[model samples]
Target: MTSTAASPPILQFTDVSLGYGDFTVLKDITLNVARGQVVALMGGSGSGKTTLLRAATGQILAQKGTITAFGQDISALSAKQLQAMRQRMGVLFQQGALFTDLNVFENVAFPLREHTKMSEIEMTKVVLDKLDAVGLRAAAHLRISEISGGMARRVALARSIVLEPELILYDEPFAGLDPISLGITAQLIRDLTNRLNCASIIITHDVPESFKIADHVYIVGQGKLITDGSPDQLSDSTDPYVQQFLHGKPDGPIAFNYPVTPAFEQWLQQRKS
Candidate 1:
């Protein structure tokens, strides 16, 4: 088997640190997602996975180091250049983020309409084809409120892929799904990456499902990358943080309470004064 490492990376983060203002969430991060591979970004609630996504899309500039997408440094891109670069990428948000006023077909067709001048007939074919990939082609006419949460998520997936982007970012793709829906979604993510020959980065907390589909996994906590490896390699890891995250251990290197930072303590002291 040819290793995925031999594949060219679509996204690369080198010595990266991300934050809002003065509060840094992640630091010294280095990771890559190659073509045709699904990389899982696993972490707890406030562990900066979303911040990395923001940096990837150039919504926020990195505090340090570089984020390279498709071999172009994100920070160096001009505004127009960044917009062009974004056209090659897709994002599936945590809540599906479908348009409430549009029907299923229109929702999926939104990207094609906004980005391409394809005729209605051509757009119809493309929209149906993407919906079919997610097993929701027949729900084309249904309004957003008419579908189940699982079905809505699939519709969002179809919409995200409608442009056939070279890079896809999924934020909590497996969140709030029943077992059957979760399984179907996981399988679809794996199948779509293969079919599109694209890179996928899934920011999720679901371990078993993500492990089953991810080509590589990165776990983060306490403002840094704890570890990264293949699912099997992570399962065999002896690191307390890795073991704690993978097995859902209550007691380990990761504590229950959030740490009290010096900045936070200083603020508290000022309040007391």
Candidate 2:
């Protein structure tokens, strides 16, 4: 008999443990993302945000529990099945990761040409369409290195969405971005998720930026989810760790415990005195 779970989540992690061999960074983590929602995974440094991001895409092998993406066990998939699963998701790396050697058009078209047996003319049309959607069509012929950081991210976004994925994972998409770029990227995320009716997961510490786009938020501390809620609830939360991190305080729970080197301490003291 098939084990039936009523109304299973679109993405579910049941007591899932993750990390490298014999070392678990995230332990007994449980969460579910409903369809058409954006979830932000917030945390400080070393909070296992990257690990969870990789787990979502099946890039990191789960040491325990089950990861169900689109209603199937991600661990049970064969190579072909995994490839098929990955195709349904779009991932934007923190660095944008566009190929420096390739021009923007080629970079965007790479996934389509690799995954599908489309003709060159068909591939070109698809690439152009996606680039235009991200407002980078005019720079299609420019080399990756030629574009600014914001343009590079737009190109990366164009490439990720070329296949029209149902899930998009952004691993710190806002880092190193100028205010204008950060605003654009945030809007792009909101627009694309709404337009495609796909779920989005962003790992970031920029609370305000995440608040602008996230329908739901999850906070990870010391490799565990300390809390999960809507932006308003999180903003009003009095949890010490949550309060400290969210308000960017200097003497709160996280800051008091953060390691300070002797050199930096001496420097700070000298400046104050």
Candidate 3:
């Protein structure tokens, strides 16, 4: 990611409603990430965190409202213009999502070669530098499938920052990672955002882990933003759903099988008899 600067927002989503066909997965999302801050997006599964992330980076279409990135109106940009705008975005999907067939070095170099006219020799320098930043320079030639999960995540992190993008979108960066791996990943992300100075939006359920690094936090539920504030505010919130999610409570306004309660009860009674 680019080095930090006290710049204006690198990404802004204004009343955005995003989805496919007629279903709106993310509705009226409004948030802005200025340069040099890590904004965490928190919610339960199906809360539209991933959908919103995709929209912010111009990966998914916005059916209504506007999305701006790198000072360009992303929803209004042409296909080629959107592609150009994407050159400024870096994304790390859940579980790294590395190409299992490619080696680490090639995986990281893929974007550089595809987007730029740089010679292979120059591209190697960029790839190696990015690998070094994520402490994976030694794993360059290993196939992505050979690396441990944590290592793979780090490799993906390396690739995401290889372009030195102005904005980074990370989905579930801590999911399924062990405690030690999570610590390493968390510190690495914190350092990278600080050093690169790029804006970041992290989608995660790891409340404490995310709060440790986040400058701001927003939560989504029931197709809308449920709460937004700094880590402290969210942690102390009295909002029933937000509190239930943050604390991992079993019984709250969010029902576990409310939609299927009648069917479940019928089956349970039959088994009891």
Candidate 4:
């Protein structure tokens, strides 16, 4: 693992809070991602992991504190400036989000075509190179619908890296894969981050896989950062929440049922009446 202690971080969040209108989902969050690092953001469903991604991408502004990406305050960037900054980043969404009508090669080439003025020949070479990196070069001509789910995901990975982004955000990269494909994807994520010398933040619940590739890990719950450290450090944690989450215990700091509201109780009373 590379030490980022001597270098400035590529992305930083200082006491950040994020959410939709009138509701803050995560609060007082602080974290940083440095070049040549892969940080895993782990949490249960509805724990605001994706909300952090939205704030990072400028899809939504932080409700409080600051978010600095590539040394720029994303909240303060002008529309044109934000667009330019976004071009330096790439996102692999949970479902791959490929264009169903486009073939694998074209899917991977979409970002290059949209952002650069390269000729068709140049675009083809770039797309094929990225596809080859993901071990899907031969499937370049296959339609999106004709490939397996894992292949489609690889195509999405190729697309995300075709531009060679400085920051890569992966949202549930291993959500729906068999053991073999899952392991392959995890290793690929680590290899690509090292090869690109870029910063990566993976938001996933797959503890074992994420830990294998992650240099750092942050666990979120109950609207705050529960804890953060290296995978080994987290594994040694005695914090009840951490133990429960890491070991998949049925009961602990995390509850199996959602909290009930006063209105819900009143409604139940009225129904009984």
Query: How many clashes does each candidate structure show, in the order listed?
Result: 0, 0, 1, 0
Judged by TM-score, which candidate is best? 1
Model 4 worst lDDT window (10 residues)? 255-264
Which RMSD values do the candidates have, in order? 1.6, 6.9, 5.1, 2.5
lDDT of each: 0.93, 0.85, 0.84, 0.92
C-alpha TM-score for every candidate:
0.96, 0.88, 0.88, 0.95
List where candidate 2 sits over 4 angstroms from the true fold: 1-8, 255-273
What are the clashing pairs of model 3? Answer: 4-197
Q: Let me know the TM-score candidate 2 reaches against the reference structure.
A: 0.88
lDDT string for model 4 (1-273, tens) is: 767767788989999998776667889999999999999999888888999888889999999999999999999999999999999999999999999989998899889888999999989888989999999999998998899999989899999999999999999999999899999999999999999999999999999999999999999998899999999999999999999999999889887665464666888999999
Worst 10 residues of 2 by lDDT: 1-10
Model 4: lDDT to the true structure: 0.92
Q: What is the lDDT of residue 82 in candidate 4?
A: 96
Candidate 4 has a TM-score of 0.95
Off by over 4 Å in 3: 1-7, 257-273
Q: Give lDDT: candidate 4, residue 84.
A: 94
Between prediction 1 and prediction 3, the one with superior lDDT is: 1
- Steric clash pairs (candidate 2): none
